[model samples]
Target chain A: MLAWAIPTYTPAYPGYGASPALMLNVSVYVMLFMAILSLIRISVAVYTNRPVCSEEREFPEDLEGDDGFTQVGRMNLLHLARVMIPCVLLVVAIEYIGYALASFAFLMILQYLIGSRKWLQSTILSSVLVAVLYIVMRYGFGVPVPGPQVF
Target chain B: MEMIFAGLLDSISPASLMFLLVGVAVGVLIGAIPGINGPMAIALFIPITYYMTPLTAIGFLVGLNKGAFFGGAVSAVLLRTPGTPEAAATSWDGYPLTQQGKGEKALRMALYSSVAGDIISTFVLILIAAPLAAVALFMGPSEIFALISLALTVIAGIGTTSICRGLIAAGFGIAAGLIGTEPVTALPRMTFDVYQLGSGLSLIPVAIGLLAFSEILLQLERFTVKGDSEHSANVFSSKLEDRLVSFKEFFSKLKTLLRGSLIGIGVGAMPGLGAPVASFMSYDQAMKRSKNKNEFGKGSLEGIAASESANSSVVASSLIPLFVLGIPGNLAAAMLMGAFMIHGMQPGPLLFKENAQLMYGIYGSLVLASLFLLLIGRFGLRLFCKAVDIPAMVLYPIVIFTCIMGAYLGKSSMFDVGVMLTFGFIGYFMRKFDYSYVAFLIGFILAPEWERALQQVVIISENNTFMFFQRPVAMVLMAVTFFVIGRTFWVSINDSRRKKAEQAMSAEQAKNG
Candidate 1:
């Protein structure tokens, strides 16, 4: 994505330019300033052969080792990827399916990824939460909440 | 003698007395719940006040605020989970005391400290609100702009978990507030042409999304991964310290309590920076000046006293800016302002002159509310300590349900349901990915004010951009802001890194076990 700063360039504002111009000007300035500052600091550290902050060492590879769930570094990214890729992709594939159905699909995928077979409980809980969210903001506050309409 | 006699009669009429009792009862129950707080409880009742006398309505609001203040401390002390954000800081020391089997004693100190702070601040609110409002009448847009800038600076220093992340999060939050409409011309800035996008995001739904719903979602994931059930415990057995401390102990904390109260008052005076700042500042100041700083996180009784007193102290002081300057100091106060407008009373500079008796009613209510807080807090301490019995399993579903109901109750739209989930998703990702939710809130609150201020500044200067620096207050604020940001970043980075290191060590120990 193209990064930009957004300036409030109101037509009435005299000193302000076009909205896009101001945004580009600010973003470019900040991005360049930060990049140069970081480069200078990095060069100084490397050229001087000085101590630097090391991220990988401090991250503790065994974090969540005792945490009943999978550790971040050790999780089989391939297996996890195999499961998530299709489930996420399938969401858009079912174009005729309603929003509520899509929501159900999302819950099923999340539950399975987390290694839960307690389908009934997960379905009940997720459905109720979605329904309440549907009723409250949509009906009570005159706020338009999203849900399955075509189904 | 005449003033005391007359004031007592006027303050304690049958009608006022009835309202106070009802307010206290409602306060304790609402406070017992996790989401509804003292200020919010008052705000909810503000609209209903149209049906009652001013004295009764004010009495109810004040009494509720007082009761909720004490009620929140109870959950913090006994459950180790604070019912409100202010009480969250209290749990730093208060919860440890509970785990160490002194929950009852911690509850007592919290009640005593809360009562002491509320009474002192109520009196302070009475004497200061009108005079401050009068002074505020003379402030032009320039002064308001400076004041807003100073508030933003102060918020940066108010103990965020990380200064850089907090600042970035705050910037993002301001941007979020900018999304709905341009303040001057009502032109839509960022709405993608959807009719609903122009209305912007609703705060309550966003709060429900961030604080309530997403938290439940995360909690549910633990059930499968861990595959272990929790064992429930009894509520009010041995945790009570059984010793009603002597007046000597109370008197010993008097100075500390007063110091904490002043910190609370100062933080409360600034709108948009509410009780959390007051509590943190008071607790930090107390630790700095205390003889027992080493015992702060390890069930220190004095720490509990300082945090509770200062946190509740914000209730009245926060009202000062709201009434005097027509600026909301926090989300709860902003909601309260909306409710007041519903009651046909404009709470600003004109409030005192236009409605003196109503103002007096408010003052009387404040004093009465604090008094009732002490009475109910002392008696209801035992009952409140029982909430910890709820295991995470059953509570998550109920919380999720209530969050949905609260959103629906305010507006009966289904699309807002999707809005809630979307924000909930955003909130979860932000917090999970290291963004400050409170900074986002601050951005939302100050967006309109900044826009209006900038517009006025532009018009007044007639395009002389340099004129912004010419104002003395603005320049001083800007300078102080730079210094505050630098100092805040240094301390925040150190504190957070230390906490992370400590957590890492604890995880290693657990893994070994």
Candidate 2:
């Protein structure tokens, strides 16, 4: 970050009192200092509070529910993948299948994955929603939706 | 007075009224559903507002903001879950009231209290905003820089558990803001030769990504992992009298209502303290002052009044700084600032001089929104309560689609969509790490102005830092900034040490036992 903050263009404009990159440099450098301090603090705390060696060590129960840091600390990678993979695929699918078809599929898939166990109901809902959205946004509002590149 | 009347006429026009009504309805629907918030809704809808006139669009958003506060309390009273974070305090008494079969009465009280607080705050905003802007007009770049510095520090200190993490998030935000072009030289410094980044990251994509898209991802995780738990929304009381809040009953708690509104206004006027803090503080104060203290957690009307009023009042009072100094008081206000800019209006002291009628028009709409909230909350209460049963499966998918559409429609650029996706992940991680995304957002929004002010100060001072001393206001603001940072750090350190000592003693006690 410090190296990136170095001014690439040094020639000052007439009456310009400071380097153009002055604010940029200050922000980056201060952030670096704070980051280092935080790292040191974390290191010291961890060192001082070393875990006891035992065959049957009891882990503390995480009381902070879904609203807190427990979600991040013990991240379910598979769950994340399920959510993110579809999102990424939707972006790609939009280019290939157009916005309406892609959105319908994405919505149905996400709904099914998230617990709408009945596939037929999810499909009908997704289709009606996509059709209405496409008509409203494209016709009513005149906002363009992506069309299939291949078509 | 003439200008105020003209603004009122404009805001009451057919087009303005229609947009405002729709915005309020949409906002209420969004807020009544758990997992969506006012900021996220505003972010998602900003792209849609690209088609409307400036006054109409702003009035619509303001109405939306007002409606959401009241809407949040609906779920808090009906279900144990709060639709918004600020409503968490409301659920303490509100949910208990639901359990006791006075759910209708509790919801009514929450609505009445919310509207009452909103009207009072809107009135206060109208009374003070112009004068505050007039005073702000006298400040120079040095004072502005100092003021921004103070705001950034205070927000970082109060918006998070750790001031260090908040400031770090803000630092990264400022750095992100520097990526497009150098103001003085017109040279790109941090663009890394990306041609698309020459114009910098667009505000719509960033806002929608951070506030809306990231939220969708979080909700998705919660739903998929936790397995959607259905909340029972069975209203126990079917009696008409139990559902109604008489005027006498409302007036009986006037003291609590007034106290909560005042606390909300005071907190909301300050940047970063936000509605959650204000609502909790009001709840605590009400508990302390209440004669029947035991009723607080056991379905007290006063407790609901305190929490609802404080959170609702914050919706308008938080706009005080945004209107006067062009500094956003919270995340929603920051998004409003972006909306104002998109409509070709800057929201500083000059706003009064250049667009006084428009400002007054917004004020008129704000008052109108309170009335609309009352009407909607009275009639649409049952309909919106059903929003909680919409299921995470259905709602999350739709929200995700909206996020995609909002990001895509901003500039019709694929790169912006990619930026949205990237920032969504960044926001998710930031929230997980307990960083104050509010501080990050405020920092990002204010970075350009901060940079401009610094540049001006540097030129005026001829590279000498001592000029701040000659300016008393600037000097004082800078001093206060340092003082706040030092005080926050000191308090944080002391708190950690106390916690460590307590833990050690508990461990020793366990060993002895």
DockQ of each: 0.10, 0.37
Top lDDT model: 2
What candidate 2 gets wrong by more than 4 Å, as runs, is A5-17, A50-75, A148-151
Among these predictions, the greatest DockQ belongs to 2
- In Å, residue B296's CA in model 1 sits off its true spot by 7.8
DockQ of 2: 0.37
Model 1 RMSD in Å is: 8.0
Scoring only the A-chain of each prediction against the true A-chain gives TM-scores of 0.55, 0.69
Against the reference, the lDDT scores of all candidates come to: 0.62, 0.82
What is the TM-score of each predicted model, taking all chains together?
0.68, 0.94
Query: Scoring model 1 with DockQ, what do you get?
Result: 0.10
